[model samples]
Target: MTSTTAPKPRLSIWMRIGAVLLGLFAALLLLLALFPWDALREPLNRYVSERTGRKFEITRRLDVDLGWRSAAVKLDGVEFANPSWAREPYLVRAERAAFDIRLWPLLSGRVVIPHLALTSPTLGLQMEEDGRRTWALGKNTSDEGTVPVIGLMEVDQGTLDFLAEHLGVDLHAGFSYDSSRGEMPLDFRIKGRYQRQPLMAQGRTGNVLQLNAAGQPPFPLEIDAAAGHTRLKAKGTVAELASLDGIDARFDLKGQNLGDLYGLLGIALPQTSPYALSGELRKRARLWEAAGLKGKLGLSDIGGDMKFDQSQKIPSLSGTLRSRVMDMDDLGPLIGLPPTERSAKAIEGVAPPPSITEVKRARRDSGRKVLPDATLDFERLRAMNADVKYTAERIRNVRELPLDKGSVQIKLKDGVLTLDPLNLGVASGTLAGAIRIDGAQNPAEIRAALEVRGMQLSRLIPKIETMRTSFGKLDGRINLSGHGNSVAGWLGNASGDVAALTGRGQFSNLLLEFMGLDGGEIIKFLLRGDRNVVLRCAAMAFDVDKGTMNSRSVVLDTEDTVFNVSGQASLSKETLDFVVRPQPKDKSILSLRTPLIIGGTFAAPQAGLEAGSLATRGAAALALGALNPLLALAATVETGPGVDADCQEVLAQAKRPASREAAAGAAKAKKQ
Candidate 1:
């Protein structure tokens, strides 16, 4: 048994055949090396062309190394021309594509590519403005049989550059995939930047995005992005690709500064406060049929829920917004308006005049609960209301009257909107009124009413510069009504009334000065008690008509003087026509009855005395007193006219009884 085995050991048919096969392969290689490479160039070109559907060119030099288990193929250039969709061709340009082929898989009639490396690949994707995309796969391929299924061992480093002119979008990306399983695991990074600045935002997002998706159809993805100083993170699973149904899990966003966000978006929000924002979005569906999406947004102290449907043409959306108290002045700069003007001169005229009156009428309209679309809608907005206080050291009006320490409150709508009242505290009282605005109309309307009470004459006289000629401290009430489309129009249609009471006041100085009596003591008088000087008049009341107030008697009480005045005044043009009669108890200081006339606008007023009336009244009074002293005395004592001697005699007679009683008492005592 031992005999033979060792000696005959090897010589099996399979071993002999394997040796022969090896020898034949070596011999074939040697022959192939000796042959010219051009002889096989045509065949190689045909093979590459058929496989890739691209024209292929082979170089003259080909290096084959049997031991290295590889072949080096140098190509001049390669280009892939895609089939045309609408008479326009799509192209892909590559500088070179070099790869390694594993020899072991050759025997199995399979091409197992160990590694594929592309140097520089330029892909051009186009879309017409009419919405025709060039990269769309052909319908014939989808209608035909199943596409070939090939497993690629690995794609090492592949760089692709895509450009689309119509979209103004450029994409540069690098990726790799493992194709062992039917599912190819892919990891890619791409960046996109818009070519034009959007109306809502600006700036470029360089190195803005990074993404990784692994494990194929139902792969998990993670995205991180940076835009200016803002950063965002997202992660989710692509669970069902057929319908793009999946869930997105998110954590709070951080490090997003409001100022920085505005800068990135090229927007300038009103100069308010800086705030932080954080939120999450969940249950996202990107499919067409079941197009549903929901999310929540949180900004600083504000929070809300949002929902949308992509299936709708306009992408229906609904949400609620909430915020904390914010200042109204901060909104001024945002809307390109000045917050406050130190001087009226600094204040710019209203643009086309604010429609304050129109807004008021609209609010008063009976048709709808809402103030109509003419008014700005603050939808579902809520906040803590705050009061705006305005303090000015001194305020000067158009009449050149200066007011001091004036303050007023501006009621704010939830601390977001404000209405300017244009009122000030003066004369130990407050001026109050409301102004309504309607901005929807081309030329708006405005209506306002102001009530003034207990105003001091000393303070008010200067306000009406025309009244400077009148003297004494006066107290009165004024009511003003304004209606018009513009400031000038409103002033032109203004109507008001003033009622005044004067106490121990005198008008002598004003009269003398106005009459041009140089150093001549014409008349000196005093008022003992309260006197009514009523100004009950309407300016532009009836069809731009006017009314007036007239007084029957005005008496001035003093040691020996009595003055009676009567007048009718017109308010619109500020004209006064009056009669002044002066008389003395015992003697006449001015032998005259004067007719005084005041006429002019509020800006400038003039007064004149009639000389003829004064001379006639003086002569008559003197004649009457001389004719009947007793009658004149009676008139002087009771009716304010008399001769000085008669008046004095009557006064002495009235004092004689006390002297007579004293004399009788002394005589009786002496007799006793």
Candidate 2:
């Protein structure tokens, strides 16, 4: 050709090399299409077994094929043994699995999978107490090996089981995925027991294969679950296929009771009424938060934000809560007391339905007894620590205790709960106090200190007209400590002190005169319908010991009369016994025979004259002339510059003057 074809134009080194490579690639493709890769199954099995540190086997067959665009490897009846510590014999098994390798990567001397498809894959995942898991692939990766990129991973009719014995979790679930309809749809359903409660879950997610890749955010996910009567629903987006790191969603939870959550999570909780909640939930790594929460607590509307940190062995929850005009009745469920709503209905003669739950029945049973014996759930108290605060604009809709506005701070740590400053606006006064409860002990220990100040008595009792009895501001305090399993037990074993004081006020003249044994004035006022009496001061103090409150100094001073009272009230027995003797500034012939007596139980207190007091008047009338002035033996009055005095001082002053009387008879007890 041209004698020498012009020396063939002298082929360049690069063109010659490219031609050789093209011919080789053509030959390789032909080889790949016709090669007998199935014959290497035994060697491949051995290689897989060695690399996985597990007994990997291909029971059926293996095949390699060249498609128009890529090369694919197919494995049949593939199985791998589980870790030695796992109870299951196999960690995973697949009826068939196929992987398509990219041609360009292969041509470049690297392996990359365009897609991995699994058919009927079964997986066994287990977690042990030592934090070891059966799901970990055994010893397959080398430190110097390059990371393989898998563009797509898919499974059809996949089944997975996870067991955590120590945590009482045993779940079996099925997964399915399909992308032919344009949008990838992955769905799963599970059934199991968690924390010993029957659990169930069903959910769907978007584009799981897309989410599997690195640097990719998770797809949208939705889940609905139930544990016992509790129901939960969430719709969200999450990052990372393993750790649920970046998460944002809206969550709604509902149940017949919030306390029932304790059965699913090892947390202590008080019995609660039916509840429903909805909120915005977000999470980052080990931190989780729920904000803009709105819910119904019993019959009240509530809002709050809560955050949890899982950085420690024991998680902690912190939050702020708010409510609008919460009802004290709603709190009844928190303390195992009779439900306030039900109690109110009962008072109106509406019979409630029979209880259906064990908790409800337990509350009903406790209501029958005079004292609370319900054992607290301390297992929950040890589960976690918490700090929370709550505030309310008002509290109403309860007759036994009506409150205005209130705030309470709650802290719990190491099985101890403290309410260091429970402040409330109630009874037109301020009530502030601190309470501590230690559940670490077999019998919980409780201590409390409370004070009431600037309380207008008329605000507490509607029958007391403010116009009639300017009832003045009253101040009081109570301090108590006890160990018990219930509120009743605590009160029954309490030891403390209680005191009350009032500076000046007014009372019904007829009532005070009658109580003071001023017969002439009482009878005269009864005829005229009554008048006002000026009260200078009133005070009462008691020392509680072994569930009994003994009066230290009980005094009521009025312009016309001074009264001294002494008594012991038994909280355990709910009995009362008190004696009142009126000592007027002036002597009265008829008043010597009367001593107001209070006796009986709190449910039915009785007031009457002391025994033989009326008969003493009959006899005293004979000696009235002789003992008229000498009746100073029956009189004692104490008044001091210091507006406030201890009970002992007031009692001492009364007895000091009486000591000079030499124990006179009833004829000297009367006053005018």
Find the candidate with the highest TM-score and give its number: 2
Q: Residue 382 of candidate 2: its Cα lDDT? A: 78
- Candidate 1: regions farther than 4 A off: 1-79, 82-124, 132-134, 137-156, 176-192, 195-217, 226-231, 239-247, 251-276, 282-300, 324-672
- For each candidate in the order shown, give its overall lDDT on alpha carbons: 0.38, 0.70
lDDT of 2 by residue, 1-672 (tens): 355434445568779999999999999988977888888999988986786677888889989887766788899888978877777677778999888887876565455676777788888888877666665544522222333556566776788888999888888889887766234387889899877678999988763454235566566778899886778899988775555667898999877666777777544455766667899999877888989999876666689998887888988888998998686766766676545443223321123323323344556443234444556678777778889898998787746454788899988899888886789887789889877778898688777778888887777665667337777787876776767777767767676666777777887776666666666565566687777877777777776675677776689877767787898888777778999877665444335436789998765678988878656664555465466845532432122112323444664433321311211211121110
TM-score of candidate 2 relative to the true fold: 0.72
Candidate 1 clashing pairs? Answer: 355-438, 356-436, 356-437, 357-445, 357-446, 636-641
Error of 1 at 442 (Å): 13
**Worst 10-residue lDDT window, candidate 1:** 536-545
lDDT of 2: 0.70
Question: How many residue-pair clashes does candidate 2 contain?
Answer: 6
The per-residue C-alpha lDDT of model 1 at residue 6 equals 52
